[model samples]
Target: MTGPATDVWTVMSTARTIRRFTDKPVDEATLGRCLRAATWAPSGANAQEWRFVVLRSPESRAVVAKAAEQALRVIEPVYGMTRPDDHDDSRRARTNRATYELHDRAGEFTSVLFTQKRFPTASELLLGGSIFPAMQNFLLAARAQGLGACMTSWASYGGEPLLREAVGVPDDWMLAGHVVVGWPQGNHGPVRRRPLADVTYLDRWEEQAGPTLVTEAPPS
Candidate 1:
């Protein structure tokens, strides 16, 4: 952890949402390091309510994978119901394709991390504030160890009782997110993003500031 090899910015910048994985398993020691990194994330008033469930057993993963598949079957139509005329067909189709691809390979993950924490109180906005940072830490730690990872909430939101019961999560806890981790099948690289100047604002409203060349535009 003492060289450019462990630089924080390098790790953060290189972390990507990896979906495809190889059959190699993640060793127990590496898993411990990732979880330990998550524990160091800050929490509200140090309440530190985040909890994680790791599934490596094929039987258990199958249960969750089946739930994810069932969930995807209904997502597009559910979005249409919620938005009606405003639903974007092209965007929805793209999302559907991505969801299906993940579902097809769900069982390949060497480890699946289920994140949960106490439900937020009415007074608090962004209830996931405490939990998500910890989840990010978990992913970054995995990335640093040369493992690929991805985080999503389809199981929590769409799979519902099936997923909850399979994992034995309590009703009092909200499912924050899920992360899939394993050896990547391909090389990793920096993801595209909007130029920082286009997204960042200065002292005045609508005023663009910061370096304009932070990233290149995605391919058209």
Candidate 2:
């Protein structure tokens, strides 16, 4: 298949997380392309035991949405997320509002439940090295298709059992990640990042590679 109509660098730069979606339908072909990209991600021992479950039916999505609701009880407090004052219009406030919308409507969007085979010798973190790259590919592929997407921590946030049973995932597989995909109700632009040099280090951890701009300084 031809590469997506977007440049690689452009896709990477613009592939920001999207939460709110319209009622527009997402076709199977588009999703298949994203999954195809996912299969190309590297895995340990070339033991590609990753499995993906597509949750599109209203019933399945409702299951996820409900779990998301339960998850927020833990997430909001730990993260210190307070309801943004209606008059507040800062970047953090906007992000908070979108995040809340996602939690409320997660089940209404098409999502994928990614899982990896569990082995006696492999810890979940070790297995994540095998599976997360595939999820990255899926995210990039979705962006290339001009679809919006974001990885969800609903499972890790205490929704794993409900999601696993709802999707009938086998016990031998660990729930690696989950992502929501759909036509975006938002815009995609250059992703915000710290100056590369500040984040990147040279040969030694003690060495500063570049001028350290105060990361928390107010934007000019």
Candidate 3:
């Protein structure tokens, strides 16, 4: 962790959402390191309820891909229902294209699904509050090591039964989502964001006088 402040900034800025990836496999040692980092994430009452199911084998990955595809089919129509009437047709076309590409790429990526044991609403929020930060830490650490990843929840739609069966998860477990990791196939660059003034409010919850950058600089 010892480094110049600028080095930290560099790492943060370089972390981006990577969808495409190389075919090379992530080794055991690296995977272990990432999992170990996840263990340090904070939890409610120290009730660290997070569980990870890593799908590494080709067979297992295929199972996940099939389940995810089934889930996406049920979800796509629902998504179409939520769009505005004025939305561009080209945008929808592009989205549909990306959906297929993501599906095809999914089987080759390293997938890890997260879960938590059933709990009351408050406890569930606390568990999520604890787990998500750890998940971010894991993603950032992967980025620092030149790996790329994206978090996706599309698999949670109607795929829960299949996931539970495939992963042998207990009846009381709740599925949070999945994260895919690999060496990115494309470039990483600065992301587009809105100016800060639009979203931020001053002491009285009103807009401030200065121009604001909408997106915070990517986490370092």
Candidate 4:
């Protein structure tokens, strides 16, 4: 709510992954508001045993930055991330550039660590059923507040020990996600996505939800 109030549909439709950010820092009030939004998300069995840790101080962010660097080593190779030049105008190249830039500047952004209480019988994916919705709420709230955010895997990659030690996470808490938030240096989205007709199904898995779209419709 730090920014002007936006309609729900507009907010949902425009929300997209934002990796590039400005030098401006997100204030405490705005961050708290987004965290409040996260609390509104539903969890399996209504356990609501989620916690969020914020790293904003220089010392803490330095730790996050170190973790981000470690994560990039794993990310870059596996994803075949390449450095893009001024001449490179392709979509993939641009995306890669943004990814790298975010890692390089991670220390400057405010990072949030989301955690859920560990349950004896639950798998990680199953545990995510309780936490991912809260995380989504966090993302949407950030987008609504005119803040740019990107969820990172720094804590899940080779960074678990580093971040856990830096944040002093309890043994019972599992790190669900890491997200960086800041004022965007780039533009917001009219996000690109596949048409609904391409993804939806009707009453059954085998049924098409919309008219069939054949590429190059046979000579009319």
Candidate 5:
């Protein structure tokens, strides 16, 4: 287990979203640890309405991959479009390109953790507040073991019906997302982000705080 002395900040700073994974196998014991961490996350009123279904068999992965491809076909066009403001064109293009690349490679990972939750009624729009944190906890736990993972909501796009039936999830449950995990085909490194000052605000909007996200210099 990773201790407090392990510098969680560093672990968090370098935990980039990994899409291209190697052929290395992730054992059951390792995945169980990640699930344990996920269960420790706080949920709305302690309801903990989350459920994780692990997909390992090639046939199962193929189903998910096909569903994801359908989702990409529907979503990629939106990402490629020019936003009304036009200021986000470049970012949109990059995202579109990444999704395009990830489409064909989705099924090749070690495992896909299917995140699901009880269906939320119109009154409970905040249901995601409980499930998303658990997903993050699982991701960070995998990162601690030098594994790579990425969370994708493609399951909810156009393939939700097919995926729900294939995964054998009941109608009362809704898909939260999918987390694909495995060893990386490439190295893990720091993720790019805006400077903290640009995003942080003090007591009021535009009242900025000092940067708290710092990284050490690389060896020469």
Candidate 6:
């Protein structure tokens, strides 16, 4: 288990997005703990309005997976539109291959659908502000506990309606995203990300230098 003071910088630095997972089942107790961690996340006015729908049963997983596949097929043409001709063809090929692998492996993991009651834009931002921290905590906790998980939003396309119907999500609720969790079967490593300097600004939003640091520094 990761200690409370395991060096905040180190924990943040080591976290990575896990895509591939193993067939090992995440136990009920562990899942509950993960949810508990999520609930601890801050929310708008401490409203804690977030709701997590865990899809564990084989039947439910099948329904959601089918819906996801259907939605992906519908969006494939649009995905092509976003790709540029100058893009790295090799990288795109690898990404496409991974997408197909995820499709085939989708049924093996548990799907968690996160939601919140619909709110106006400002309120929604506050609500999201609260939920995402908790989500990141959940992901970090999962990584610490040796579980592989990845946050994905592909289900939010045209599949939202099907998901709401299949999962019995309330009419007043809005889907945030889906998180897939399972034990990892393959290698997990540092993810490629832009440097901090390229993203962060000193004072104003646009005031940034060249790439700050490519890889995160380990805690001293």
- Number of the predicted model whose TM-score against the real structure is largest: 4
Q: Give the clashing residue pairs of candidate 4, or none.
A: none
Put down candidate 3 lDDT per residue, 1-220, tens digits, no spaces.
2111234465566677676677888887777666777778777777878898898888878877887677567766877623224454684664455455566678777878878767766666766776787677776677767777778775567677877787898887777777788777666544445666666776666756454344454453
Q: Which window of 10 residues has the lowest lDDT sum in candidate 6?
A: 1-10
The TM-score of predicted model 1 comes to 0.78
TM-score of each model, paired residue for residue: 0.78, 0.89, 0.77, 0.90, 0.79, 0.81
- Candidate 5: the clashing residue pairs are none
List, residue by residue over 56-149, the lDDT tens digit for candidate 4: 9899999999999999999888998878887998999899989999999999899899999999888878898899999989988988888888
Global lDDT of each candidate? 0.69, 0.86, 0.69, 0.86, 0.71, 0.70
Residues 179-214 of candidate 1 have per-residue lDDT tens digits of: 878777664557566657677677888776655443
For residues 58-148, what per-residue lDDT tens digits would candidate 5 score against the true structure?
Answer: 8778877887789777775865532234344675565554455567777765555445466455233477777778888888888877888
Q: Where does candidate 1 stray beyond 4 Å?
A: 1-5, 75-101, 119-125, 210-220
Residue 16 C-alpha lDDT in model 1: 71
Query: Which residue pairs come into collision in candidate 1?
Result: none
lDDT of 4 at 196: 65
Model 6 ranges with Cα > 4 A deviation: 1-10, 80-92, 120-123, 209-216
Ranking by TM-score: 4, 2, 6, 5, 1, 3
Model 3 residue 125 lDDT score: 72
- Candidate 2 stretches with Cα past 4 Å from truth are 1-5, 210-220
The residue pairs found clashing in candidate 2 are none
Question: For residue 124, what is the lDDT in candidate 1?
Answer: 31
State the displacement of the C-alpha of residue 214, model 5, in Å, after optimal TM-score superposition: 10
List model 2 lDDT by residue over 31-145, tens digit each. Answer: 9999999999999999999999999998898988987898778789988887788999999898988888889888788899999999889888989999999999999999899
Model 6: how far residue 123 lies from native, Å: 4.6
